[model samples]
Target: MMTQNLLVELLVEELPPKSLKQLGQSFAQLLAASLEAQGLMNQNAVVTAFATPRRLAVHIGNVAAQAADKAITQKLMPVKVGLDAQRQATPPLLKKLASLGADASVVPQLKRELDGKTETLFWDSIATGTSLTDGLQKALQETITQLPISKVMTYQLADGWQSVNFVRPVHALVALHGADIVPINILGLQAGRETQGHRFAAKVNPIALHNADSYAQQLSTEGAVIASFAERRAEITRQLTSAASQEQLTLIDDDALLDEVTALVEHPNVLIGKFDAAFLQVPQECLILTMKANQKYFPLLDAQGKLANKFLLVSNIRPIDPAQVIAGNERVVRSRLADAKFFFDQDRKKTLASRVPELDKVVYHNKLGSQGLRMHYVRAIAKMIGEQLGGDALANQAYEAATLAKADLLTDMVGEFPELQGIMGRYYAQHEGLDDDIALAIEDHYKPRFAGDELPCKPIGVCVALADKLATLVDMFNIGEFPTGDKDPFALRRHALGIIRILLEKKLPLKLDELIQQAIKIINDDAILQQWENSSNSSEGIAVRRMALTLTNHAYIAEEVPVLHKKLQEFIYERLAGSLREQGYTAQEVDAVLGLDPPLPLILKDILKRLVAVRAFAILPEAISLAAANKRVGNILKKAKTEGFDNLSLEELSLHLRSDPQEPAEQKLYNALIDISDITNTALSTDDYVTFLQAQAALKLPIDDFFDYVMVNVEDKVLRNRRLTLLANLHSLMNRIADLSKLAT
Candidate 1:
C-alpha cells in the first residue's frame, strides 16, 4: 500500500484568541478521525496542527491516496418470493439483479440463508474505495461543521449576495496530498496551493507551497511567519525570557495570557516598555491586572516578585528600527496605568464605612436583597461564629470586618475591575486606619476563590469568610434558588465547597449543623424586610408584601429548614469527597470515613484525623476480615428489625442486654469490647484516632469467634435480642472513627 503525508490550510481574518488553540487541535483530530474511519489512514499516523492569527492548518502522515475496497453483504428478497416453482429465475429476482448491474444470468449465484424462519436471498459484492480527493472533501466538510466555534462571523462571498458563516472571514483554502492538489472547497473558497504569509513581514506576497511536507518551512523561511501555534508560543516565551533577563526582571508567567498572545500574532517581537514611576504607587495587583487584562501585556517583577515599572509586550511586526513600536506600546500602557491610579486615588477619598450605604442601591440579586441587606446577615452570622470560636473580642472584630466586606463594590477601582472587589476593600480599609485584622479580613473573606487557592490566614478572616459563604447558601436555598444540574447561577456549589474547605483544612472547632442554624437564624431575622423591599416599589405595597412573605416564610421555614440543611450538608460532603479523591484518597476510604454518624457534627472538626486513621486501619492484616464482619453484623441487625425486632436503638438494646442471657461466644466478645473501651475512649478524647483504631484491632479475634460460633437469629426472642445487642456494641466500638462496613468490598 502506498501512503503520503497530507496537508490542509485555511487562511482567514484574525481568529478569536482564546479559542484558537482548541479550534486548531479539533480540526486536525476530526479530519484524521474521518480519514481513519474511511480506511485512508492507520492508527500509527501522526497529525501536526498549525494555527496562526490568520490561518488554521494541519499535516497528517501515512494517509493513503485511496482507501481499500470493502466487501459488503446485501440481502435480497425471500427465497420463496424470488424463485419460481422450477427453481428458475423469477421476474422479481431478475429485476433486483438488474438494479445491482447484474442480469438474470447471475441470479443463480445468489446464496440462500434462513433469517428468522424466512429463507432470504443474499449477494456479496466489493464496493470501490473512495479516492483521496473525495475522502478529503468529506472530511473537510465534517471538520468545519463540527468545529467547536463559540461564535461565527458572516461575510459576503465573491458573488456579493451569497454569505457564509465561519470563525473568521476566509481568504484561502489549501489542500495537498503529497505534491498533488487534493481539490476541495470550504467557506466559499476553492482549494489551491497558494497561501498568503505575514501581512507585513513576508518576503513574498503569496507563498506557494511545493508539497504538504514543506508547508511549515516555506511559511517560516519565505513568509516570515511562525506557522505552528506551539512554535509561535515557544518563540514568544523565549523572547520574553531573553528580554526580561537583559533587564534583570522576571516575566510573570500566565499560560492563558501566553496562548492569547500566541493567537494574536503570526510573528512575535517581544519588546520591553516602561511607564512612569508614579503609577507604581497604585497597588501592584491593580497595575498587574490592568496590564494583563486591559493591554494584553506581561508585567515584569523584580527578584522579590514585586511589580517593576517596566513591562513586556509582543508586537506582530519586526521593523529594522523597532523604536516606534516600543514607544507606541509604552504610551498606550502608561495611559491605562494612569487610569488605574486615578481610580485608586479617587476611591480612597471616601472611607469604606461611607460606601456602606451606597451598596443599598446596588442590587445583589433580584430575589435576595441588595448588598447592604446581605452584609447585615453576614455580620450577624460572623459575630455568632466568632463568639463560638473565641469570645466577645473576636466577635466584635468579625462583625466589623463583615460590615465593610462588600463596601468595595461601590468603589471606583472595583467597579472598573470587578475581579479586584475584595482586594480593593482590604486596601481601602487599611487606608481608613482600621485594625490589621479587620483590614485583612475585608480582603481575605474571598480567599480560596478557586480550587487549590489558600484560605484566610487569620482568625478574623476565617470567621467572616465562613459567615459570608454560609449566608449565601442559606439565603439562596431559602428562596428555592438551589443549583440544578450544571447551572449554578449563584455559585452555590462553590460556596458549599468553600465552607467544607474552611472547616476541614482550617481545623475549625465548628459544627456544620450549628453553622447552618446560625445562618438560618440570620436569614429568618431579615427575611421580611429584604423580601418586601425587593418585591415592591411603594411603602404601602412593601408592607403588604412583607406580611405575605412573613406568613409564607414562616411555613416554609418550618417545613423546609431541616430538609434544605441536610441537602446542603450532603452537597458540601459530596464536594469534599470529590476533592479528597482528587487529592489521592480512594472512594471507598472517603465513604468509610464520611459514613461515621456525628453526635454534634462538630466532631467533623476531626474528620481529617479520622481519615488518616481509616487509611492506616485499612492496611492492617485483619482489616478485610473485620470489614466483612462489620458488614455481616449490619445485615443481621437489619434482618432482625424486619423479623419484628423493631426497637434497634443502641440504648434500647443495651437495656435488654441487662436481663437477657448472653451466648458463650457473645460473652467473650463483650469482655473483649469492655477491655478495649477505656483505652479507645482515652485515645478518642485526645484526638488520637489512629491509636483508637489500633486499640480496636485487638478485638478482631473475639469478633471473628463471635461470628463463627454464634447464631444471631436464634429462635428464642431473648437470645436474639441479647445477640443483637452484643453485635450493636461491637459495631459501635469498631466504627468509633469510621464506618467499617463501608470499607467492605
Candidate 2:
C-alpha cells in the first residue's frame, strides 16, 4: 500500500509557438486524467504542467504503483435459461464461464439476481489493478494521440526507415516514478531519466532528473530553463515592466503576444531597442502592428499613450555584452518598419478615393458581386442609418466613409498584413485630407471586432460600422449562408453581435426590423441586384452583364429577405439575451424581459432597461403570487383560445367581459382589472416596467378570490367565453412588460 510521485516529459524540436501552451496543457491534463481513470492516480493528486520551446512535461503526486483491485459483478443469463430443469450446469452456462477463464466447478458459486421479471445469474470477480508501467504507457499513448496539433510533421527516426508523425520531431521521452524510471516508449523513443536542456545556456548537459518532485527545480538550476509556461510568462512580464519603468514608458500589453513569446523562449531576456524616430511618421498603429506581429517586440508608449521610438525585445539568450543583441533586434526591426513606411508612402501616391474603382476586381462573395457592389450597398445603408440617427451632414460623411472603407483592401500594406485593412484605410484617408470623421470612421468601422473590444468612437464611425455589418448579414443570409452550429464561415455571428452591441451601447433609436429591411432593400436595388446576378458570369478582365433584370428576376434576394429578416431579428435577440446572461443576469430574468416582445423601440438599451426593471420586480413581495396568478391566467386563456373560443384582439377581448353581479368574485375582479388596466397602459407607454408591475399588486387579491370561488369553465357557453375574456384581459395587463408566466415556479 505505497504511493509515489510521477514525472513525464517529451523532448521535441522547437514546437509551434502559438500551439505550445495548448499542447502542453492538454498533454498534462489528459495524461493525468487517463491515469486517474485507470485508478493509478487519485482524484486529489497534485498535477503541474511544464512547457518550453522544445518540451512538454508533467509532474503528478500521489500516483499508486498499481491501481487497487476492483470488485466487479457481471450479469450472465437468466437462471432458467442457463440451467436445466434440475438446475444442473447447461452447455451455454459452461461455455460462458469458460470464456471468462472459469470452469464448471465454479458454477455453484454464481450469484442470483433479479433483472426485471427474470431471475438472472451473475459472476462476481476481482479485476486485477493495472501496474504503473502499463497504466503510464497507455495514458502516454492516449495523451500523444489527442494533442491539439494543428498540423503534424512526418520524419524518420534514427533508423531512417520508419516514420512517425507529431507536432515536431521527437527527440526523447522521459518517465519517472518516484526516483525510478518507468519503462515506456512513445514516438519511437524509450522513456528514460535523461532530457535535453537549454540549447546554449544549460549548466549541465543532458540534464538527468533525480526524482519526480525535483523536476522543475532541477530543470531550472541545471538546464537554465524556466519550464513552467505560467512562471516563464510571469518572469517575462516582470522583466518587461521593470525595463519599461526605467525608461519612463509603457509596454503595450497583449496576452496573445505574451503567450507566443513564452512559447518561443526557454529563458527570456528583456532588452530595450529603438527604431528611427521617422518611422513614427507612419501611423503608430502600423509601426506597432509590424513590430509586434512580425518581430514579437512590445512597443513602448509615451505618457500620452502614443507609440514611442523605443521598444522592448524578449530575447531567448542573455549575452555578456547585450549591446550586440539589442543592435541586432534594432537592425531587423528597422527593415520591417521601412517596409511598412514604404507601403504607407506608396499607398498615399494614389488616394483612397482613387482606389475605390479598383475594388471591382475583388470579389466579396461568389453570390454577392464585388467589393464595389458591397460598398455601394454599404453606402446606401449608411446613409439610411445616418439620416435616421442624424441628418444630411452625418449621412454625407457616412456615405463617404463607406465608399472608401474597402479601398484599403487593394493597398500593399493591407495586402501584406490583412489585419491592417481598416487601419491602413484610416491613414490613407488622413493623407487624402478628408474630414477627421471620415478618416476615423474608415478605421473604426471594424471596431468591437471581438468580445470586450471598443465600438466606433464617433457618430460617423457608428453609422458606417452598423451599415457594413448589416449589409454583410443581409447579403450572406440571403444566399442561404446562415450560420449552422459553429460554422460561421462568413462571421455572421460576429457581425450580428457587433450590430447588437452598437445598437444597445450607442443607444440608437432606430428600429431593428426597420434597419434590417433597409439593408435588404439596398441589396434588392436594380443596380446592385443585377450586378450580383451577372457577377459570376464574367471571366478575368471581362465585363459581366445581365439583361437589366428587375427586382423580381433575382429570386434569391426577393425570396430570402422576409424569411431572413425574421431570422435575423430572432438571432439578434438571442445574441442579446446571451450577452446579458454573460453580464450576470439570470435566465428567468432574461426570459421575463424578452418574453414581453416589446415592439419598435426594440433598441438594445431599451431591452436592457426592461431586463433590469424585471430583475428588480422579481424581488418584490407580491412577485411570486402575481407571477403564479399570471401563469394561471395565461394557461386558462390559451386553452380556451385553442378550444375555439371567440379569440378577440386585446381591445375586443376586454369589451366582452362585463362586471356582472351574478358572480360576485368575477365582478370584484372585473372592477380591479379596470383600475389596473389604466395604470398598466400609462406605465407601458412611458417604458416604466417596474411601475406597471407594481400597479398589478392591487389585482392579486381580487384575482386570488376570483380563482378560489369561481370556475372559469362554467357549463354556459356564453359565461365561459365571458370568463375567458376576463382572464385574457388580466393576462394582457400582467404581460405588458414581460410574460410573467415564464417566471412562474
Candidate 3:
C-alpha cells in the first residue's frame, strides 16, 4: 500500500499567537489541497495542525508514499509544420519524434481528406513516480513563503550573506515521516524531526524530537504544551466551567475573545483570580474589555448574571507560583480599567451633545475635513434615509443622534479605546438626556461591523448608520481615497456592504443611486465648498476634494451619471451576482442576463433568481436552439425593426424577402419572434422573470424545425435575407428571457 505519515513543525521567534493558529490551519489546508490536486491521496489521509506562540506544527497521517505515475498523452498534430504543396510532413521530423520516445504514424487525416493529404502525430506519456516528500516539500516551500505578510523584515544572518524575510525570524523547521526524515526547507530552515515547545515551560532546550509520536509525548510531559488549539480550547472550557461551578459563577461566553484566548495558550490551565471589589464601580463593559482584550481573560458573572468581580485567565503553563501570575495579570488588567474609568468620568462631566462642537478639531481624514463635518453630512443623509423608510420620527431622532454620535469620538473614552467607539457614544448620549431613539442610534451605527454581524433593526439607527457610512464614502470620493485591494483604510467597502446588507435585509424601497446622490450633495454643498476654499492650507485641500469626488463618481460606469451611477450599479450587480452564485447560478448565466438588462440592483436580483429557477426546468435544449436561431438571423435584420403588429406582416415580410419564400417556415419563425417580444415586455412590466423564461423556451420546437427544414443561406438572396431577419428577430426577443446566448447546452 506504501502508506506513510509526515510531521512538520515551523519554529519562529515568538510569532503573534493570534495569527499563528490561523496560519497553521490555512497552511495545512493549502498543503492538503495541493496533494489532492496532484492526484496523490490515501483513502484515510488526514491532516492536522497545532500552534503555540513560538511554533506551528502540522501532522499528516495515512498518506501515499508516491503520487501515481503520469499517463501517455496522444498528440494528434503532425510532427512537421509544412512540406510540399501536397501539405505532407517531412520524414526527418517524424524520425526526430521517434528519437524522443514518441510513437508516430502517417495516415489519412480523420477530419480532412485529400490527394496525398497525410500527417504524422507523435505522442509520449511519461510516467512520473514522484514521492510524497518531494511534492510536500515543494508545495510547502512555495505556499508558506508566499504568505501575505503585513509586517515583516529580511535578516542577514551572522555567518551567511543569505537574507531571509519572515513576520518573525525563523529559528528551526522539523519534517519527519515516522522516524525517517522528510527533507524540506522553507524560510531558510531545513525541516527535520525536532520541534520546540512552550517558551515558559521549557525555556532553553524544550524540543528533543526522535519521532512524531515521541515528540508529541515530550511536548505534553516536559513542556506542558499540547500544540493543538482545539484541544487547548476544549480543555480550557471544560476546566473553566468546572471551576466556575465551584465558585457559583457563570463564565461569560465571548467567542471572539475565546479565539484570542485560545491563541495565547498552548496547554490551557483555567484559573480564577479576584480584583478589588471597588473596581466594580467602573462600567461593566469597561471591566470586561480590560480583562478580555487586555489580559486575555474570560470574565465571570455571579448567580444573578452580573459581573462577579472575578475573572478567569487561561494560562499556557501551570506556573510554579500560580498566585504570582494571577497577581501580574490582575495588576495589568486594573491599570486598563483605571484608565477607562478616568476617561468615563471626564467624558460624563459634560453632556454628549456638548462634545459635538469639539469634533471639528479632530480631522476625520486630513483630506476629508473634520469629524464634525462628517457628522453634519451624516445628519442630513440619515434624515433623508429615514424619510424614505417611512420612519420620519425615527429618522429625525437618528439624525439628531448622528450629529452627537461623533461627539463621543472627541471624548477621552473613545481616544483610549477605539473599539468602544459606538459603545461610548450610546452611554454618553443617554447620560446627556438624549431621546431613546437618539441614544440607540449612537450605538447601532456600527451594527454590521463585519459580514456576519447583524444589521441595525431600529429604523432610526439604520438611517443614521447608512448616513454615517455614505458620508464617509462621499468624502473619500471627494478626497480621492478609495479602497484598493486590501487597503480600505476608511473601510469604504464595509460601508458599501453595510448599505447593501441593510437594503436587502430590511427590504427598503430606497434607490441606491438616490441615496448615494444625497450624500454627494451633502459633501459638495456650498457651505463645505466655502469652508474648503477658505482653508489657508497651501496643499490645495478643496481642489483635492473636487478631484476625489470626480474619481469616486467614476467608480461606476452608468448611462446617466456615469461614475457614481455606475458604481452603484456595479456594487449592486456584484452583490446580486454573488448572491445568485450562492444560490447555484453559474457565473456565465448571471453575467449574460446582467449584460442584456439595465443595471438595476433589484432587477438584477430578480433576473438572477429567474435564471437559477430556470436551470431546474428541462428547457436547456430549447434555450440553446432558440439562441442559435436568433444569432443566425441577427445580421439579416440588423438594420430592421418591427414596424407594427397592427399592420399585416405576411405580405410585408415577403416584400422584405427578395429571394424565394417558403411559406410555413417563415411564418413559424415570425410567430415565435412575435410571441417572444410579448413575453419580454410582459416580464418588464410585471417583473415575473420565472414565467417569462419558460414562455421564451417554448420556441425550442419551432426553432429546431425552422433550422432543420429551412435553408437560411438560400440561393435566392432576397429569401435568404428575409430568413436571416426573422431569425435575428427571434434572437433579439430571446434575450429578454435572460441572455439565452450565455446558456450553452
Tell how far residue 548 is off in model 1, in angstroms: 10
User: Root-mean-square deviation of each candidate, in angstroms?
Assistant: 3.3, 3.2, 8.7
Off by over 4 Å in 2: 78-95, 527-560, 597-601, 642-660, 711-722
If the candidates were sorted by their lDDT against the true structure, best first, what order would they fall in? 2, 1, 3
With a 3 Å backbone cut-off (N, CA, C), the pairs that clash in candidate 2 are none
Taking the tens digit of each residue's C-alpha lDDT, what string does model 1 give over 217-259? 9999999999899999999999999999999999888999999
TM-score of each: 0.92, 0.93, 0.70
Model 2, 193-245: lDDT tens digits are: 99978899999989888988888898889988999999999999999999999
Q: Is candidate 2 or candidate 3 better by TM-score?
A: 2
Q: In each prediction, how many residue pairs overlap at the backbone (N, C-alpha, C within less than 3 A)? A: 0, 0, 18
CA error at residue 133 for candidate 1, angstroms:
0.9
475 in model 1: Cα distance from truth in Å?
2.4
